[model samples]
Target: MNESLHGGVGKAQIKLRTQDFPIKEFVCQHDPLYIRALFLQAKTEFLLLSLDLTSLTESMVYDLKASVYEEFNIPIENIWITVTHTFSAPHLDKSYPIFIKKVKEAVQLSVSRALERVTKLAISTDSVTTSLNCSRNIETPFGWWLGRNDLEYSNHDIRILKIYEIKTDHLLCVLFNGDLPPSVMADSYLEQGGKAVSSDLIGYTCRKLEETVTQTAIFILGAAGDQRPLEKSCEDIVSEECLKRNDLHEAGFKLVETQGDRLYEEICSSLVKPNPIFLPIKAISIYEKKVFLEEKVMPIPTKELKPTKHFDFSKTGRQQELTIAGVSLGSIVLLGIQPEVNSLFGEKLRELVNVQTVFIASMVNGAIKYLPEEKDFERVTYTAMNTQLGRGSSKQFLEEVRRFLKESNLSVDKQIN
Candidate 1:
């Protein structure tokens, strides 16, 4: 396939999320968050924005989409905005109007710069298997807990999308999707009594990769509902009994550095590999479908779940209406999902779908909670309880995705693996 790929890649650094707070509240010492944009044009336009933040609300995404559309004349569906799911960065709250403004400005600037330098592109795809994360669903005396289950499943394969400037064959941007959450320092605190706002895993690694290659790199969070970093700074990642201060709060940055180093090395080694396609994309079709999910109700007596965060399910509505969105770039489809989908169900999706590759942005647009498979409900795992969707929600969502894929002409009567 041969075609010209237009658009460019750009990034803008973000100030500390807690910069306006008191001295004790300041979190970042070294690493800074960023908003990166990748705008491409084939048959369908694509403007993908990757944020080094935790999450984005549905309403916020809508407004951001509108702003990008106003600036770039791109449709809302063609704009894919996603987060790194970095726990180190503080969530956006009502009081952070200044930071919000900064974010909005950064988005506009990044996209504007990208549009100014629009260039033809060539693309290639590759993947590297990793064990950086393990399933965080463990069975204990008290039901399934949010802990390391080393023997359990995780999306070990990191998908790579390398985009290059066709004229010079210079790497312009690289998008890598991994299953690990950038939360290695999620619970780490400073010795002087403050939390740090480092980029954690994905952001740190991406920064390193960009510096090494002298190009843009974006981190897309993959299906990681049941996955967690094997190297966490907290003591109780395995269990509450895992003790107090498993890692020195101040030295937790070292763990993050190590995690980032491991990830960076893996990707750098595979930056250019054997037999890459480097094909010019033929076309792109952005598609989405609405799915209404019922809130889960336990049928039997179970231990009360202590979730880390509780989203206002009621605010969303009586039934959760999530979208199964995708950007089909010829044979490849980039899935943009709001919730953290279980790795197994994500695999099921790959098996059922007929696309050459399906790289799922696990937590995009919004964070509803984890969506585990129907069989996983029996495990009574933390994901099962933490999630708002009822049993079989994952299955229902898979069906909806399949239907949408067929409707969009992105799938055929074929199976993958």
Candidate 2:
């Protein structure tokens, strides 16, 4: 059950631009934003919906989950909703009501279509490396700013989960995971008076893959709180003659195409390699827990042109809770963590799990600011300053994940015996 609809188009009445950058209007539409869903009904039913938006609010998540449960008998815990984190799309607030209604309708339609075309599933996992993303925390004298920094850590692994039709060998869905957003590469267009609302790199990559194969491509964002795409420098932009009439837009589109093409080629190369050993279908085990994050009043720097006063910072409130959810799919485990997560936490979780495959889907339930590692707070990085969770909170969340995996594995073993 794969279908896509126009999320929205045209300039939004209200714009919540990324990094506080302003845009007068959305000049063009590169491609239609899609709400893609893939439903799997095995021993336990599961539904995964992917969107081309930046983020969804907690209330929206609750409403969507309730609606899905009422329409289909799927449990709230079994429904996993995620966003691609593309910055070019309109603010969910402005697109709300209508946008969310369309999404709900799409989900219902997908589920109905899925029931009609049920097929045996074969799943496999594969990953490849690409130079698409880099760390965005620059170390400055004031503090760690949110800018492109070559020294900071970045995650480059593009993990892919492929589901296929058992008899026809046709690909059903391809879930690709990475820690970079499509807007990273095309941000320059916004600076150059480009007003096009595009899905950017993620959309390009998905489109290219769909063109190559007859399958629905779903993108799942990883720990990308401190990550961004490797953008073209000013020199590179000048070399491309972007100053000439609307050439900036053309250059931006070209950049997206080149990056998307490279990613598609990498995925194709990995797919052609020896197929991964498929894991057996087992009873799906779902675990969910909410950890209360200690709230703290962080000082925000003043926006004055010059510091005339002694006190240049003001206090503000941060997030107060973190929701973690996990679903066991045989050898593969899907962990969904609310809010933006740093890559280091995801890396640590993978090390602790020591599993064949672990999908850490970040910004799952809602957006609650950044969740940086404990050590990162010492640097007072942008993520650290913006985070609601205090130091060692990441460790606590990791422990919860570890426990869930261990208990789930034991449960599976006992059932087998």
Best by lDDT: 1
Question: Quick one: best TM-score, which candidate?
Answer: 1
Those runs of model 2 whose alpha carbons end farther than 4 Å from true positions after fitting are 1-28, 94-96, 185-194, 232-250, 274-276, 298-319, 407-417
Candidate 1: segments with Cα more than 4 A from true spot: 17-19, 22-29, 237-247, 297-317, 412-417
- The global C-alpha lDDT for each of the candidates, from Candidate 1 onward, is 0.76, 0.66
Q: Evaluate residue 60 in candidate 1 and report its C-alpha lDDT on the 0 to 100 scale.
A: 86
lDDT of 1 by residue, 1-417 (tens): 244667799999875444465423454555788899998888778889988888888888888899988977888878888888887766766576777777888899888878888888878888887778898776654456666779987879888888878787788888898788888887667777777777788888888888878478998888887888887777553444532236578777788888789888888777757555766467777887788877765432334444322222222235788977878776778878888887777777776567667787876766678776755666656676666787767767777777777887777564333
